[model samples]
Target: MDFKTEFKPLTVQPQEIEGKSFEIITEELGEHPFTEQQYPVVQRIIHASADFELGRSLVFHKDAIEAGIKSIREGRTVVADVQMIQAGVSKERLERFGGGIKVYISDPDVMEEAKRLNTTRAIISMRKAIKEADGGIYAIGNAPTALLELIRLVKEGQARPGLIIGMPVGFVSAAESKDELRKLDIPFITNIGRKGGSTIVVSAINAISIMATALK
Candidate 1:
C-alpha cells in the first residue's frame, strides 16, 4: 500500500515562511496575557516548538522583557547550562553590543570540581558562572540540576543575574525547578511543566536580542 501524498510549502523564502508562520500562530493563539514586548518572545517560542500549549504556559516576571533587553544592550555576559544553548544563540548580534555567551559545563575546572564533590557538572557550572557573569543572563535548558543550583545560588544571595531564563527539560525536577524559580522576586522567564529545551531558550534569547538590536 502506498500512502504518499503531495504537499507543498506556501513559500520557499525563509523570511516569508517565518512571517506566515507567525501570522498563523498569532491567529490561532488568539487572546493571551502577554504584553506587547513579551508577546514576541512567546510567538518565537511557539514558532520554534510548534507547541501552542508550551508557548501559552510561559510565565514572565514583570521586568523580564525590560531586564533581558537591558542585559543585552549592556553587553553583559550570558551563561548557558550546556553547549547546545551556547551554540544556538546569535553571537553576531551579541558581539555587536560587546556581549557574549559562555557555557562551563565542559570546562576542566567545573568538571574536576563536580567529580570531587559528587555533583553534576550542570550544578558546578552555574556556581562558576555567577562569579564571572554577574548581572548577566543565565539561560538554562536541558539540565534540571543546573536550574536547581542556580535557584539555590539566588536564595543564598550569591547570584545577582540580570535575567534568568530557566527552562530545563526532563522528568526529574524539571517542573519542580521552575516552580522554585517562580518563588524568587527577581526577573525571570520560565514556563510550567517539563516541556522546555535549548531550542526554545535560543528562540527566547534571539527574540530578546532582536528587540535589543532594534533599539540601537
Candidate 2:
C-alpha cells in the first residue's frame, strides 16, 4: 500500500511568525504562572527550544522583567558567560539602543588569570566583563563557574549588573548555581532543575530586547 504525502509549508508574513509561534506555544503550554509582562520571556524560551517544560521550570523575580526591560531601554551592555551565548543574541536588536554584546572568555588576560588562579576561564572572564560593563545584563548560559563568580562579586559589592539571566546547562553545579542566584536580592531570570543552555539564555535576552523595541 502506498499513501500520498501531504506537506504544507508555513506561509506567513515575517512579522506574523513570532505572534503565531507565541500562540502555538501558549496553546501547548496551557496555563503558565508568569504574568502578562513576564509571559514574553517564557514564550521566547519555548519558542527557541520547542520545549514546554520551560513554562514550568522558569522562575522570575517579581521585578525581574521590569528591571530587564529597563536595562535594555537604557542601552546597557550584555555580558555573556561564553562566546556561543554572545553569538546567539541578536546584535542588531541590541545595537538599536547603543548596547552591545560582550564575551571575554577568549581574552588572553582572562586565560592567564584563570591559569594563575587555578579557576575556570569563565570565572575570570566574568570578573573582567563586569568591570567593562558595570550595570549591564549578565547572560550566563554555559558555565556554572561564571554564575558562581558573578554571585560572589555581587555579594562583595564589586559587580552590580542590572539583571542576571542564569540558565547555564550542565549536570555538575548547574542547579546549585541557579539556587544561589535565586537567593540574591536582585533582578534575575532562572529555571529549576537541569534544563537550560545558551539557546534559552539568548532567547530570554532577545525577548527583552524585542520588548524594549516595542516600548520605544
Candidate 3:
C-alpha cells in the first residue's frame, strides 16, 4: 500500500498532542485477520473499517499447545518448552517462563527441520493472521538487502505496512537487518544476541500472548 497523504510532516513527537493527528501509513485491510487488539490508538485509525466486536481471534493449534505442555510435564530442560508461557523474563511471576536458554537458526538443515516440525509454520501462520487484519509483517528475514528494498519500496510509493515485527534470529546478516529495523523505528519483540529459531519465535509469541493475558 502506497501512502499518498502526508499529514503535517513526519516529525517524531515525544508525546501524543491533542487535536494533532499523525498520518498512519498502512496496507489495505480487506478482511480483518487480527483477533487481539495490539495497539488500541492506532487500531482506531488504521482499522477504522474493521468491526471492533470482531477485532482479532486466536485459536491455538491444540496438538502444538499440548506438546509444549507435555514437554514441561516430563521434566525436560535440555530444549525450551515454549508452549505454555509461565511468566515474563523481565517479570517475577508464579513460575519462571523459560529454561533461560536461547536457540538460533543458522543452518539450512535446521531451518528445514524447523519447518517440517511445525515450528516455523506456527510462527508464520500467527503472523499471517495479524497481517490479514492490518498490513504485512515488516522485518528482515535473513536478507538485509531485501528489507532495505522493501523500505525503499514503501518510501518510493510502492508498498507500506501499518506495523513491522523485526524478529530475525541469527545469520551473518542478522545484525544488518536489526540495524535497519532500528533505523525504521518499527515495533517488534526480539531476543538478545542471535536468538532467532523455531523455538525462539514460538517463545516470543508465547511471551506476547502471556503479556496480553496479563494485561487483562
Of the candidates shown, which would achieve the greatest TM-score relative to the real structure? 1
Error of 2 at 194 (Å): 0.9
Better of 2 and 3 by lDDT: 2
Q: Give me the runs in candidate 1 sitting further than 4 Å from their true place.
A: 1-10
What is the TM-score ranking, best to worst? Answer: 1, 2, 3
Residue-wise C-alpha lDDT for candidate 2, range 126-185, written one tens digit per residue: 899877887989999989999999999999999998999999998999999999999998
Q: Tens digits of per-residue lDDT for model 1 on 1-216? A: 986658765667898889999999999999999999999999999999999999999999999999999999999999999899988999999999999999999999999999999999999999999888878899999999999899889889999989999999989999999999999899999999999999999999999999999995
Q: Write model 3 residue lDDT over 29-79, tens digit each, in one string.
A: 334543333333223322322333322321122232233333323222211
Every model: Cα RMSD to truth = 4.2, 4.4, 17.8
Specify the highest-lDDT model's number: 1
lDDT of 1 at 18: 93
lDDT against true structure, model 1: 0.94
lDDT score, candidate 2, position 109 = 96
lDDT minimum window of 10 residues, candidate 3: 78-87
Q: What C-alpha lDDT, on a 0 to 100 scale, does residue 44 get in candidate 3?
A: 35
Candidate scoring better on lDDT of 1 and 2: 1
Deviation in angstroms for 109 in model 1? 1.0
